[model samples]
Target: MSNGRKNSMQRVSDSPRLLRLGAGASPARDKQWFCNPGSGAWPPPTIPGRIMMMNPDQNSDPLFDFADADDYQRLRDLLAAAGFLDESVLEAIGINDLPDLASDHPLLLDRTAGGSALHTLIRLFLMEMPVEADTFAQAIRPMAADSWLQAGLVRRHGSQVTAALKLLPFRNLILAFDLPALLQTPQRSRYVMGIGGSTITLSQLTIRRHCRQTLDLGCGCGVHAFLAAPHSSRVAAVDLNPRAVRLAAFNARLNNISNVDCLEGDFFGPVAERQFDLIISNPPFVISPESRFIYRDAGLEADSVCRRIARQAPAFLTEGGFCQILCNWAEKDGGDWGQQLAQWFGGSNCDVWVMRSESLSPAAYGSKWIRHTEFSDGETGFSQRFHQWLDYYERLGIASFGAGLITMRRRSNGTNWFCADESPERMIGPCGEDVARGFALRDFLETVQEDAALLACRLRFSPDLRLEQQFTPSAQGWQVSGSTIQLARGLAFQGNSDTFMANLMIHCDGKRTLQELLPDMAAALKADPARLAPLVCQLIRKLVEQGFLLPAGQENES
Candidate 1:
């Protein structure tokens, strides 16, 4: 990283606070007033009386209590009618991004000032700002505002009312969870996290094929379980945090989804011996020094939680089932990260694919996660915590941390393969189909390991494939100097190739075997096919692995 970027990161890491609240909200007051229900610290020593207590039993808790199912349905409909779904809320706020804990709230509030009911909802729930009672009441008309207040969705103080919980409209469903500010406090260890980048990334990476059963292991607020509900006959959402379980159950009811069973237990203990066709988890895999938060820390040693999940997941997966996990793993100095990760899945009876996204040094990793939870602590406190984390890493002999998605498929009979590669920086859209295709392609490659077998099988270029050439000004006018072959969508893998390779890619039309195409390829290169066969086979295998080419008649398999 450049010095400028490093300085920027340092500033973010050392910042005193994350949330910048609007009027009537103070960080000190929030810290003093807010407390987890079952932490034996409820009713803070100095209570401002502005915030109400959240019941330990979520069923009795106002936030989870839905006296009337229609009321929740009406709430969902009201928000949807006002165009408060998915990314539309971002567009309505005149911003292309969702507001986070570090977002400038006052500026966002000013942008949405004096706007429609949608804007009111945005300011109240999304921005976590206090709204005028009259404005809030008007925004939620037809459905009595008292219902919202009674349900503990919002708390009133004099004429102003603030949302007690966050209502996130994501993927056409309204998910309820604790406010983002709660995440910054140690007291709120049981905080149920709302939608985050990891949640969305795991959802996109998950295979969407219809399944007999789906398990959302470590399911927070049931986002993955809900996403898997439509295609799955039954979905089981398990979490160690009771608060998360309650919120997930409440969300399922709020969305009128009856197929998801939300349970609270550690890891796979809740559904022991029960097999699932698909298992997805965005587990608490952060390799932190302390287990302060349930949603982020696993209370285990360095990366042990992730390793445990990988080792145990295959036992719960039915034959040919997939287990996809988003996690962080520790990397030792001068050690191979891939080989270490492969050891986690050794003798697990599964084919593992590790798509590493990024690796960061100990300092960088410590700064990033510390900035996330301890941002509320001032610079001095942040510095202390940073050094403490560094000490922990040093004691553990850790050099860096690797963050990415690990996908494993339960293979009963065939020789299982372990494939590891750097993932593409960006995905065009949902790449679940691409993930399935990748496994199938890997399997195909395994079957045709020999040169003769690979050449005997006909292959075709991916329909989304595109080849581009760049010309340099040479004595010979416009001679092609370089070229690249790329997939236009789905994983969007792209790499440089020469003229011979470009021509070879275009010729894979599923009409001719590699043996047949070799003659034309060799003629273009003015070389004998006998001598060029091995080189051609090597290039074709690479193309197939990168998804630029597919075996004939297997491109469209689910």
Candidate 2:
């Protein structure tokens, strides 16, 4: 509602605002916009279900294709017999190239890039049991009955799906998939892993009251950037690897999304002074001595990527903007991750919600990164990479590490900070909106508390809202109402609150009576006296802001 934000949103939301996003617009500080390339509109993916993540064919046209269970299985068997399914090819060739593969494992070197990549797709995903008893059906299983595969192939060689998939090599991605369906895959599949989940999670939690610009730092293959393109006037997608930038661009083209501007740069440098309404990232959290391949490792800095992301976000978020991230951190000699997060807020009225999804010791962490390189087929080098991870952790004195999802919101209040670990039990569906509400509500609470001491407070939770009864004392100065009180129907105030919050506080100067406060209250709200009087009276029926008309004092005071 701020003037600056209003103008920014208006300018960015042009009907033709869906062009390549101006990734450099700093939404954290200045309200001004930079480059604006007006593409008609975002080519949003038409989803068949409420769950967009499972829908891979999220485009006007889809280039990647999937096969039916029986036929796809037959293709897999043929490829395996031809050596295309071997791990050796996966390790050496890199999965993206397909057309050149013509040897015995033609799928490995002679097939089109998209189709060749499909083989790696299978190699990366976990195998689902065949519906029948026999695990080996002489061919590859489609891995899923998902529609993303059958929805029609993604554009193959060029702009159109059929056009892009002009050749047999490309057609395989459409006709014969390599990986299992994401929806059908088991909980944790080695074959299907990457930054997809993190980006999706962050996207759900982003606050969009109309974002002028947005940025996806460390945008691997540009999936996150693509998602952000729809809501933002302009979007900037950045990654360190040239190949990643190319792939991200390719993905954008495939998705028919023109608003995302893929850039090559490290965090915050390319987007200097550009503030945004939202910033999201699934940065490299896997702690490694060296950030090899730029795909997984966060480098020798040990949580440096996460820390930098946290530290830099506030600088770019507008007064009411927000940033969300997923990261992994080292737990040093009893140091709690929550404490570190608290410090990261930098006194901004920021609320941080983190869900500790998993924790692993130094050895376990090392092995996970080691396995990512398994496709390389160099046993000795794999061992070396594994040892490097262990050495990095040991030398840094890391005992255990934790990984989690985080969302931060910049509030109107100056420099207030909140930190807590979210319950994994409640991390269902998508938690983006829940996280955003936490920040927005926290901001509202801070503003409200300034007018009244919640010494005696109660909360009557609504069924429609996802909330819990909880209270916290801020350095023993102020305490919030507990879930029990908030979930109840009545207010147990110290005294009857006979007036609106602003009315009560203003007239609390001790000279004005109820009659005297009515005029100011009506004027502030611009409401009629008849309607206003009863509303103010009903507030007193329970305890309102002014502590003069309620039940026994301290009824539920902690």
Candidate 3:
């Protein structure tokens, strides 16, 4: 490890002592010391100091309380009956996309002005706007308004009732979480974030194979855990923020998900002895100078939190298990960022694949992150944070910040391989199966390193593969000037190709081995089979890696 990384680890190690001081102490005292009022210390104190004592009767909290499982089920059924699902709400709101921030609520409310039950529900829950008591009562007919108020779903104010939390209908599951506006307050440090870009990316990147046990490290509002519930026999969701843990547990109950257990602790400390078949984390990975938010910032310096997770996650994973994390890491000046990442997995016994989506210069990175939370802060505050972050990056010699998904699969028996590359520009939908297939393909490629072995394997083009040809008008009746091949969905990887490669792909129907196809290919090109064989093998390897082509038996895997 580098000296910077060592220092970061030491800082993290020293945090526990501060936390030990608050052991067996009252929650009020803990909160008072950890969150010093008017101190203006961004995250108030150290990372460990943010750990709050979880209430024994967390479920009974007015904001989180639901009468019972049946009440939860009733609320779900009522929403469904009122057309309050993701698709229905989107259609009713005259928007194709769901509202991500509180700023989008005005448009949603305007579009959902119709006085129907669905519109009323949308205004009440989705828009987080207060509705008249009679309108709210009429909207939830079967269930009385008092029931809703008693369950803490809504709070009455004069003649109107407002939802206490934001209820999002996501992927057929309803997740209740802290409102977006909460992030602007002093309590923002512990505010639980709802669905966002990182959450969606990690969900799509995760390998969805059914497992005996799964872990959602730094799970906020239990979204990942709920997504993993049906596929996993049991899931454990852990976070350091007590409020996040409480809300995640509340979300599980609201969604009627019994297999998930939400716990409050830092990193893997809560589940030290437990092993999981799958582990997914979208931890506090912003590489910032200040730790202002538990959901976005880890108090450790640089990208130490992500590095620590990469180094320690393997021990908690079972053989053949997988751990996927969405994170940001520093790119040092004149250094290979990929190599730096590879070192994090040294002796981890895991095959690692890093799909870096984007990298931004230190100035750009600092500005973007500072603006995310400090947008409400006037110009002076924003400028101060931006300069402070830039100075921190300069002092640490950071050139840029790279953000993306890191997927690791444990393999105890063989030599682990590390693959790092830029990810596809866009993903159409869930690509969990593609992730699993990528791992399998890498394993196959490692075994068939020899040309002879590769030639013996049969291959087929992916069903979603597409070929595009570009032509110029000046070139005699639309003659092809360039051609490219791409996938229609999933990772959506694309690459430049030629007529010959396209024809070769047409022949890859899993009916003929590469050795058998080489003769035909060479004959079409009027070339020697020996020369064409090497070129074809290389192309095939590239196609398989990009997921445009799959080995025979793997066609049906995804």
Highest TM-score: give the candidate number.
1
Model 2: per-residue Cα lDDT at residue 407: 75
For model 1, give the 10-residue run with minimal summed lDDT: 1-10
Model 1 misses residue 489 by how many Å?
Answer: 1.1
- Order of models, best lDDT first: 1, 3, 2
TM-scores for all candidates: the values are: 0.87, 0.50, 0.85
Model 2 residue runs over 4 Å out of place are: 1-195, 347-351, 375-387, 444-452, 455-458, 464-558
lDDT (10s digit) by residue, model 1, range 1-558: 000111111111111111111122122222111233456542223222222234344343454655665786787778878788867787766665564523776777777886688888988888878888999889988788778877668889899999988998887789888886776555467677777777667767789999988998877788889999999988887766656766777787678776676665666765775899999887777777787766666677898877888988899999999998877899988768898788898789999888877788999988888877765689999999999999999999999888777899999896789998777645767888999888999999999989999989899988888889999997878899998777787777777889899888888989998888989999999999989999998888878887889999876774
Candidate 3 lDDT (Cα, 0 to 1): 0.75
Candidate 3, residue 289: lDDT: 73
lDDT of each: 0.76, 0.46, 0.75
Model 2, TM vs. native: 0.50
Q: What TM-score should be assigned to candidate 1?
A: 0.87
